[model samples]
Target: MIITRCLRPSFLAKPRLPPLSGCRQFWGWLNAVFNRVDYERIKDVGPDRAASEWLLRCGAKVRYEGFDKWQYDYNGLPTGPLGKYKIQAIDATESCIMSRGFDHLDGLEHLEELKLCQCIYIEDTCLERISKTDNLQKSLRRLEIISCGNVTDKGVISLHSLRNLEFLLLRDLPGIQKKEMILELLQKSIPPLQIELDLKD
Candidate 1:
């Protein structure tokens, strides 16, 4: 891990380049997509823009529109044997991927992990969209919804759509005051989901 981190920056240090061709493409895509924000390095500039930039740097195909929104464009990319999709974190903030922003993640055929740790606008709709993903039912293994203010029992209930899910982490939401639905479904289900929650005032 340390070695990979050390070599990532050498991506822009030299002009001729080395065997790390992916770095070249990484920068190329960042420049092409943002077309603004002179990206010297992946730094969090706030408004979740930095997270978006970092996700792009990490090799995820992305699209941005309006003030603070983004989506993965996995269309032109390969889809057969070695399709590139194993998203472990969606560490975005400010306005990135709010409300129905998860609509962007719907068909990501290989996404294995999800993180919406903190966002003001994250709500049931986003969770609903994530639950409806065609690929999530088959591939998702872990999920995190931490400190998101707008999510509720409705959103948590929507998770029933993720039949293949194995682990879940829910924390610090204003809604979801009761545990009947959350407890009843998950506890009785087969291949029981590993659940962790913190809903304290």
Candidate 2:
């Protein structure tokens, strides 16, 4: 895969903080300018205070790690205009990543990859969003849910919509009960998709 990391511009002046009520609009404008560039990978380690909000603003794919104490409501993250680039991967293994709602990922048409390692609260509804969004499932290619206790058969079934998927890795999921569905989805969704299935019941 082609990976590119472009540093945020240093000369551009940061916008003034808007009120909480206008968060959506603020996020929309933020995406308009920063979301156009495509990047294969991005890591946010520093505590910019606005890191979470900024992430929502830019449709850039990112890898977030090392901030175990940082906390943000995922619903607050921006989803941009329909079909805009949304985050493709998130490594929250070492951090406290919480979703305010499953709809936080709604409208993320270009998301292709996702990693939610060690995120404790993600549930089936979040996965349902994956299946419900035609763009996400059709475009998604890789997915990794490791050591996440809440993901289950229903969540696995959500992947059925991923027709272009190629790689899937599920590890340490003790609650997933639909192994047959998982295998069937992989087989039917994308006959050629490379997959790795691991379950501990």
Candidate 3:
């Protein structure tokens, strides 16, 4: 799997390319001779605006950690007709959003691991969308939500649908007051699935 890294704009410009003419010539010549590099390194080439476009063009596994917002173009995420997807992990911790963060991600049929840390606005509704994904019961294995204050029993209940899930981690969420209740629900939902529960006030 090709790993594409997106760097900040300030950092991209610092690389000090020789000039557009040199870059164009080098790329033109390289393309003619080689099979094309699987990994394309991009820095601040355009707003995150072009990020989705590039993902489609390359068809490579992505690790995008920073974006201006929590919501992204739905078309960019892997979905049906696109065949198996290959995003190993996504860390959208501090990004901005009003509600659930997984609605647009329903198409990622091959997503194995997901992380939402410090996304304060994420709630049960977001988790509901994630649970509804196709083959999610069999595809997803690990899920982690930390410091998401709005998450509660409703969200925890939604997670019960992940039948094939192996690891679940929840921490510092004020809404889940009854730790025992949460544990009971999980035990009943997917009794054989291993879980890691943490509630420290």
TM-score of each prediction: 0.56, 0.54, 0.57
Q: Write the per-residue lDDT of candidate 1 for residues 65-159, one digit (tens) a residue.
A: 22133354323422323222234345444323444234335435555667776655568987887787777778778887888888888888888
Which regions of candidate 2 fall more than 4 Å away from where they truly are?
Answer: 1-88, 94-99
- In model 3, the worst 10-residue window by lDDT is 34-43
Which residue pairs does candidate 1 place in steric collision? none
| List of clashing residue pairs for candidate 3 | 100-126
Taking the tens digit of each residue's C-alpha lDDT, what string does model 2 give over 1-201? 999998879778587787887997675454344423222222222222133443443322253332223233546443434323334454445233333333334434445667767765566766776677666667677888788888888887777777788888988888788787788866886789777877886
**lDDT value for model 1:** 0.59
Question: Which scores higher on lDDT, 1 or 2?
Answer: 1
Maximum-TM-score candidate: 3
RMSD of each: 16.6, 18.6, 17.5
Error of 2 at 16 (Å): 42
Q: What is candidate 3's lDDT per residue for 64-175, written digit by digit as tens?
A: 3332333344465533332222444455555444232233354345556677777644778878877877657678888888888888888888888898888898877778
Give all candidates' CA lDDT scores.
0.59, 0.58, 0.59
Full-model lDDT, candidate 2: 0.58
Q: What does the lDDT read for residue 82 in candidate 3?
A: 27
